[model samples]
Target: MIRRANPADEATIRDCAEQAYRRYVPIIGRKPAPMVVDFAAQIKAGHVHVAVDGDTFQGFIVFFPKGDHMLLENVAVLPSAAGRGIGRSLIGFCEEQARRGGFTAVRLYTNEKMVENLTLYPRLGYAEVARRTEHGFSRVYFEKIIGGPGA
Candidate 1:
């Protein structure tokens, strides 16, 4: 089950992020990046959501409202839950939220080294809008226009 995340889930979200991102870091060759946002800060910003399986918190996604678009911040699923569709569910949640807010599109960025998402996003209807080198990494930016509530 996926639900809105609150400050109380900060530690769990952070732990999940540490494990998932540690695995990702090796492939990208980057130092560890924090998985969870500053709990208090994001809760105030209201952009964090959590994915739970019974009592286990499996993953989380964060996106920020930017004018008419939603900016995907981060989405992390524990390595143990990687193939169970948790990541997809979290993304669906984001889309639902965007549609409800009447957002025109959802935008996000991923490094070229992350082959899984490079393939997954396009397959899921995301289109590459731009590519560039930033912070020593080759980043691909994507956007999916959400065509209203029924779309």
Candidate 2:
């Protein structure tokens, strides 16, 4: 099940992100953005959601409203839980949240070196909107219009 993350879940969320993103550190030559987030602050601000199986955390997604749209800031799955559709489900949850909140679209960006996401986002109906270098990383931005024409 997926639900809003509580302050108590912060450690598990960080652990999951670390395990999920550790592999990319070497490939990208540095820690990915998600690895350095302040989970406690995010949870207190009501922006973090976690995917759980019983008492075990499988993954998490973080997002927040941005004007008329939503920004999907992070999606991470525990290494052991990869390939179980957790990432897709978390994204679906974000879209649902955006639609329910009357947002027009969901936007997200991934590092250019993260080839898996470059392919997966398009397959999930997100269109690449732009590419740019930001915060010392090459980032690719994507958006998906929800609850609208061509959504």
Candidate 3:
């Protein structure tokens, strides 16, 4: 099940992000941005969602609304829980949220070094929109048009 995250979920969220992103440190030469996010603030802003199996959290996704679309700021799945479709479910939740909000699309960015995501997003119907460096990190941006054009 997927649900909005609460303040009490902060630690689990942080732990999940750390475990999920730790492997990328060697690949990217630094911890990924999602590893350092403020979960409390994100929960307070109502932007965090967790995919849970009973009481255990399997993954999470955080997003911010941006007028015509929503920004998918983070998506992390516990390494132990990988290959279980949790990450894809969280993304589907984001699409549901966007459609309910009357947004046209969902936008997201991944570090250039996360090769898995570069391939996965496209298969999920997200088109690469741009690539740039910001805050010293090379980023690739993507957008998935939801519902229909100009939705």
Highest-lDDT candidate: 2
Per-residue lDDT tens digits of candidate 3, residues 1-151? 9999999899999999999999999999988999987789999999999999999889899997997899999999999999998999999889888888888899999999999899999999999999999987999999998974334
**lDDT tens readout by residue for model 1, 1-151:** 8887888888878888788777668787774334434766875577788998898888989898887798987898988888999999999889888888788799999877778889999998999999998767788899999877667
Alpha-carbon lDDT of model 3: 0.92
Stretches off by above 4 angstroms in model 3 are: 148-151
How many residue pairs clash in model 2? Answer: 0
The lDDT values for all models are 0.83, 0.93, 0.92
TM-score of each: 0.88, 0.96, 0.95
Q: Per-residue lDDT tens digits of candidate 2, residues 18-71?
A: 998888999999999999988999999999999999998899999999988999
Q: Over all chains combined, what TM-score does candidate 1 have?
A: 0.88
| Candidate 2 residue pairs in backbone clash | none
Q: Candidates 2 and 3: which is better by lDDT?
A: 2
The 10 consecutive residues of candidate 3 with the worst lDDT sum are 142-151
Q: Which window of 10 residues has the lowest lDDT sum in candidate 2? A: 142-151
What is the clash count for each candidate, in the order shown? 0, 0, 0
lDDT score of residue 34 within candidate 3: 92
Deviation of model 1 at 146, angstroms: 1.6
Q: How well does candidate 3 score on lDDT at residue 44?
A: 99
